[model samples]
Target: MSSPWFGSQRSQSMTEFALVAPILLLMLFGIIDFGRLLYIYGTLVEAANEGARVSIKASSPLPSNSDVENAAKNGAQSLYLANPCPNGPLPPTSGAGAQNPPGDQGWIFITEPNPPTTVETSPTYDAPGGQSPASATGSCSAINPFQSGTYPLQVTVRYNYLFFTPLLEQLAPSIILQAYATDYTEY
Candidate 1:
């Protein structure tokens, strides 16, 4: 009789573990996914900075430089994603990294002073990086053509994250991470 009771207790423990394990695993994946998203976001920001620096490399090139853009894209490829940006992917128009797919491109946002217009950019990222990637024009101080001569350039890169758990999916159908870095260019 004691043997049967002990066996029943052990079975109950296993049942409890089975019930709790999935939730715990899900939580663990959620934590990992979130951490990865943050890391990717930072990487994108760095990539943008690299790209923005490209414009200032030679004090501006004619009609923008595609090689400069590729340098930015290559910098981002270091953190290459298995499931690149699904929200939007912009292809390299020209330069070294032109062979890369649209999903692996870095986007540029140029706002010239006084009614800024987009100088060069991808199809999906025609807008500037605002307060947040999604914000409009970043609530930025109005551009002054008389005072500031430099063109404000922002590089925005996107990354698509594949989630292992459903928790993250509930937040969004597909996790598209974005990073932006802004710089001033005389050109």
Candidate 2:
């Protein structure tokens, strides 16, 4: 003459936990992995911004793209708990004759608007009100304003992120992170 459900209640609870434990563990790991990914993205963005700021300030008398890239790398290293490249700086140049002075290469192209030029061969057709022949219908010329003017700086950082956690690595391949920043020269 005992209670009908008393003896079975504990077994029911145990069975429930056994059924749900794996799902709960999976969800926890998934959350951790997502958080790690977000952290990596934030680090990359900050690094790019720092590099762009350094480049725009003209920290180097003649700042090159390589200089900007290095700045970004330094920023990333500062943020990363475990750096991907442990040895030294990566080579900035593209191919043969790539290695030179630290800042020999990696110059970024700066384009400028060209000046206007008068067309010589066009006929001077008068407007309805006869408005000085429309300034001779000049054509625009191409000019390199950056030759003497301060130009905007852009920095790009490319990183291959390898996952060390076996759980995440098996699920997802290596990640690629690209960061970029652009700003006008300080001066």
- Best-fitting candidate, scored by TM-score: 1
In model 1, which range of ten residues has the least summed lDDT?
139-148
Tell me the lDDT of model 1 at 124: 26
Per-candidate Cα lDDT values, in order, are 0.48, 0.44
What is the per-residue lDDT of model 2 for residues 36-124, given as tens digits with 9 covering 90 to 100?
Answer: 66776677777767766665563335444445556666667544322222111222333552222221112111111111122223322
Candidate 2 Cα RMSD after full superposition onto the native fold (Å): 16.2
lDDT of 1 by residue, 1-187 (tens): 5675366677889999999999999888988877866766777777767766764443322224354455566667566532232112233434653323233333433333222232122222222222123322322322212112445655555555556567767776455555566666543
Could you give me the TM-score of model 2 versus the true structure? 0.52
Poorest 10 consecutive residues of model 2 by lDDT? Answer: 124-133
Once fitted onto the true fold, the runs of candidate 2 whose alpha carbons sit more than 4 angstroms away are 1-7, 59-70, 77-148, 163-167
